[model samples]
Target: MRELLVLLLLLPGPAVAEEAPPAERRTELLYLLRQDCGSCHGMTLAGGLGPALLPEALSDRTVEGLAEVIRAGIPGTPMPPWGFEITGEEARWLARKLKEGIPP
Candidate 1:
């Protein structure tokens, strides 16, 4: 019974979904998006030095893919990695928000 329980504990379980960031953190993230990302993606997120971040522009991309880009950034480009400032879960949330189209 002890061995069986140990085996069960060692086995992989179902994937756990990450919870959304708290309201205050979400607000701060949004502000970072507007200020930092906006510097390249455009204040309206339409387009600028970087491509547009609007929903339509992101429609073909997967949330995970976008999140990876957000976390890792494109190398050899002006884009800089943001992994230091945000967690992977937060990156996913931002990716989802971009896909949904942020409200004006």
Candidate 2:
């Protein structure tokens, strides 16, 4: 009974925090990932101090390739790996959002 009460109380926080739509959530995550990860990869993902991430530029690459980039940034560049900042799943999610392009 006590355990059930705790679970009930805790569920709302997680649920409320997930208010964004799946795509929106992914977009926000991508923005954050870009900001955190892009600190080195260029704020616009256009390869400033780092490599570019333009969709047309990466159109030929597989999502896995993109995920790898997110997981482990390009070597010999200012970009450092982010394998630990977020999980593979999160990386993939970001990749999908990038592929979709930031919605209007």
Candidate 3:
């Protein structure tokens, strides 16, 4: 029983919310957003081949849903999975930023 208890204690706990990426990484991520994502979403994210990422445009979407889309991408669409390039937490942060409306 004690061994089992110790094993349980040693097991990894459920994921906690991750801290925002470091400022340097944040800068890189934003650059990627503007240069890479922007190529498809529009330089201003005002909707081009991809839909607008403005707060109002994403008002109906949940952060988790947006994160999933960012990581997984939409099948049959031009969007490609970015999971290989960015971490899930980073994606979530980007999703939140998009929902809040990133500055121009």
Ranking of all predicted structures according to lDDT, beginning with the best and ending with the worst:
1, 3, 2
Show the lowest summed lDDT stretch of 10 residues, model 3. Answer: 8-17
Give the per-residue lDDT of model 2 (tens digit) for 1-104: 33433343344332344323354454456557566756765676776666666676677877778889878977987667778765677777566556644322
For TM-score, candidate 1 versus 2, the one ahead is 1
Quote the lDDT for 51 in model 1.
97
Query: lDDT per residue, candidate 1, 32-96, as tens digits?
Result: 88889999999989989999999999999998999999999999999899999989989998898
TM-score of each: 0.81, 0.62, 0.81
Least well predicted 10-residue stretch by lDDT in candidate 1 = 8-17
Q: How far is 52's C-alpha from truth in model 1 (Å)?
A: 0.3
Query: Alpha carbon lDDT of residue 28, candidate 3?
Result: 71
Per model, state how many residue pairs clash: 0, 0, 0
lDDT of 3 by residue, 12-104 (tens): 433224456765676778778888999999998998899988899999999889999999999999998999989988998888778877657
Please give the RMSD to the true structure for each candidate, in Å: 13.2, 10.6, 13.2
Ranked by TM-score, top first: 1, 3, 2
Name the candidate that leads on lDDT.
1
Model 3 regions more than 4 Å off:
1-18
